[model samples]
Target: MNSDPDRQVPFLSYGFRPFFLFAGLYAVLAIAAWTGWLALHDMPGVWITPTFAGPPQQWHAHEMIFGFGMAVVSGFMLTAVPSWTGARRIAGTPLLLLALLWLAGRAAIWFSAFLPPIVVAIADLAHLPVLAVMVLGGLMVRPAPRNLVFFVFLALLTVANVMIHAEWWDFTSDTASPALDAAVLLLALMVAIIGGRVVPAFTRNVLVMRGPSTALPRSFAWLDRVSLASLAILAGLAAAQIEGPPTALVAGVAAAGHLGRLSFWRGMATGGAPILWSLHLAYLFLGLGLAALALAHATGMLAVSAALHLLAIGAIGGMTLAMMTRAALGHTGRPLRVVRPIAGAYALVALAALVRALGVDLLPGHYMAVIYVAGILWVAGFGIFSAVYAPILVGPPLPKNPPSA
Candidate 1:
């Protein structure tokens, strides 16, 4: 490692460094805990208390979305926003404080049963607003309109989180579901936004490095507008609980638009690289999940929960894993390539998504068995990831620039 006096502590030097590690570990541990709760909640002597004072299902959903999901989002935004807005990277004390706030929230929620409800609410809901402020601070430096758009979404997500806690505190009724649904849709929108930029750009870079010039991914401005607008409309309707054929039709349109949009991204070119292929597969899940969601609401042939899991476990989970691994390697001064074990990790998560999203219905008689298998695979995948990448995330970042591939 370079011994420059300017080099800060490894873990606190960059936002991605610590947050990625935490997210990976949380992904594994949270799922393992959730699985245990699901399997043994009814057992007479099981004392696995998450300290959630609300419905266990609500606790699980909230943790996955605001917990695991936001950590990855924080890591990504803190790293990527600087690149986007030409601002200095957040580091040192500020980053550490931000990370600590996140950890505090997780801990508060875990021990909520013992804490006063107001204290739990304050502790749990504090991270996102602070994150929004950090992000806005960066975006304000140069004020890129495109990048600044996320500030609005982040604020909205904060509201959604608070709304869920509101329901937990009996400040509202049946609001958690809609709030979570909105949060999920917002995350899907994020996948669309970030995935649109990175997938094709990364693919283009890889293809360029491999051979003679290849066709760059196509972009259609009009379709991009339509897709985003339709998604926003769908999210609004869902949050508002405006159930009708009209909302379903809007969702269906959005799904089709997203699917068609993904088709033009040249995902096929990414097949050779696990890093690239994983993202493509994850984006495919986003499209399929939207379609399934539309079908569920429109025709009732599929379960809404099932449809959402494709986005959750498949898209959000898959994409975050792919990004975490790729970013960890690249930022740590390593080759942007996956080894056998990492490749296996990707396959396990994909399998987990399939099992969790579909197998519950396919083998209804063996639902718990399917869930157990999915949980095991989910834990194994993230376990391998956290084990492999922990050192890289904690070590000094690379001094040299990586090759395009």
Candidate 2:
């Protein structure tokens, strides 16, 4: 829109622009496809056979975590590393290529029935390492110990992904399920780590600006360290397929630690701010979800699927949407406040998580109905995001000094 000859194409100008857009759209479409395939699977005369590398459920899990989840992670890392280290941003051709690599992985997985397993594995596995190299380049510019740990996260994620693909390649028969669990835990850990840093910082900034604040967010405290450490241990146990009392103990400790850590943040005081409260709510889910997971392991009161949906849909989905909306706004030079529709989108996702996680358990007779409701809510939330943010992301940034009102 600016028509400046020297400006990069607006969508390719920053990592967040295209990748966030893709993440939003893919979140909607992928879930929709999964739900549709599921609903039509038993219907007579239905012609909806979708071929995937694995079972439909595995394909759903894989794409949501590896495909959709990684896109958001990639976008955030690519955008943040430059900011954190004063390095040049990955943009233009390199960024475009990176985006295409992610898309290719999705395509190869969706149509893997027609493709060689080796080809599918290679195509899918290539994106993360290239992303790691790009992120490492920027981290090397400054190289703080705190920042460099993310490279390790990327490496672990790659290993988890490989574990999943190994099953497809006949390297192992039973690794995919546990590996998927590991991947989810790793992503949750990232959310916990990043959320710990930003949620309080942003909340404090808003609180201070609004008025003098008696209580501000307490971060990087003893409890925070305990929380992260416990979650990391849980992730390790998951990767190794450990079960029973030990995993339950760690998960329970992690749950208490995170919830306790959250209480120090003063989330309730951020009244009427969707951008702020959505984050708090997502963190709340992270804590509660872990608690549920611990219960699932220790007592036979909850289904594992319910606990996982709480983590995957509630914490991961809600946090990513909140961060994506907030980041897209700030980086694009738009106001940091969220519009009403986006606010409703936040509520929709939270409700979707609750319904998906607990609905069937509550009303066992309506299992399929509950699934349909949850999927629709999930789709609608991201549909709103994609529609609202498309123009903002693709358009040139607002002029720093606009014409006087």
Candidate 3:
């Protein structure tokens, strides 16, 4: 339970260090690779074969959700659970092993075309169960219902992942797309749940420190409950592959509930702080994405892929980067302020989401161009994060006190 940083090998000292650092790097690398794949796929005489198993598009989708997304989730959960349960932190050797397992999964997926499908599946599937067990053990110490719910989230994510691999194993051809949808929804739910807790709380902390403030962000209320419940329902429907009016209805309700929930958080008041406003922006995407999704199903105006991109690029990407920056800084005993590059990174990611989600519709004549631009923005955003935060993550924490100024 000690809060002190382990100095011998700072990178392996805690879960957040290695996971967050690598997640940022992988975000840049993966997106760049995906972009490259897209650009070269159609060119004459350009025989760019994929290094990853499966189709390029499938690899892109899978890695973003399970690879990049899960890495951030792992980092956050591993770092936070100890504080939540007052249990021993997973540091040193155990942390390294867990991180290595995640890296191995990425490698297995990348080279899956050459490897045995069963071996690839086993390697890629191993990380989540181990992570779930580690998290469950910690939650069991305190056993609060609220905290224990995350264990359920982890378990569901594992199931969703298996569904994706089922196609590779030739068990089912139709499962991967729906399973990926379910996975995205699950991640969006995590964002909703976690952001619900932190955004308003962090905003209120900043507001309180600033001076007297009568209108504080609201606490967990009926709207929050409704938002989460509706989203959970939609996620279940996606997993079940239920389509038509029912899915649209639930998505509409979820959209309304989430946007309504956000209104109570007083996001407008946090405009002065990039660290806080970035979160608010990310939550906004969650609501907007659901709305787009509902419209896509109901009116057939928007592509479902477009809507999911909003959730993927904006909600998941934005929120994770925002949280990673804040946590990395705070845990390293540095200021909570976002430097200019990191703040620009935040803006680039939001812009990337907007472009990716809406650009084709807005500029129907230039579909490939839109994709390329969005990919560039995504790479730049996370590239900045990886470059800027690498030292902070790998280096020792700042001293608590120093000689007099």
lDDT per residue as tens, model 3, 82-187: 8899877788777777888999999999999899999899999999999999999988889898888899999999998898889878888888888889999999
Q: Model 1, 192-226: lDDT tens per residue? A: 88888888888888777767767767778888888
Q: Alpha-carbon error at 209 in model 1, in Å?
A: 3.3
TM agreement with the true structure for every prediction:
0.94, 0.97, 0.97
Question: What is residue 290's positional error in candidate 3, in angstroms?
Answer: 0.6
RMSD of each: 3.1, 2.2, 1.9
Question: Which structure among the candidates has the greatest lDDT?
Answer: 2
Candidate 2 residue-wise lDDT, 1-405, digit = tens: 332223679888889998999999999989999888888986788877578867678889999999999999999999999999988888888888899999999999999988999999999999999999999999999999889989999999999899889998889999998999988999999999999999999999888876664677886578888999999999999889898788889999999999998998989987689999999999999999999899988986888779889999999999999999999999978899999999999999999999999998998999999999999999999999999999988899898899998
Model 1 C-alpha lDDT versus the unseen true structure: 0.86
After superposition, the stretches of candidate 2 with alpha carbons farther than 4 Å from their true spots are 1-6, 45-47
Backbone clashes under 3 angstroms, per model: 0, 0, 0
Q: List the residue pairs that clash in candidate 1.
A: none
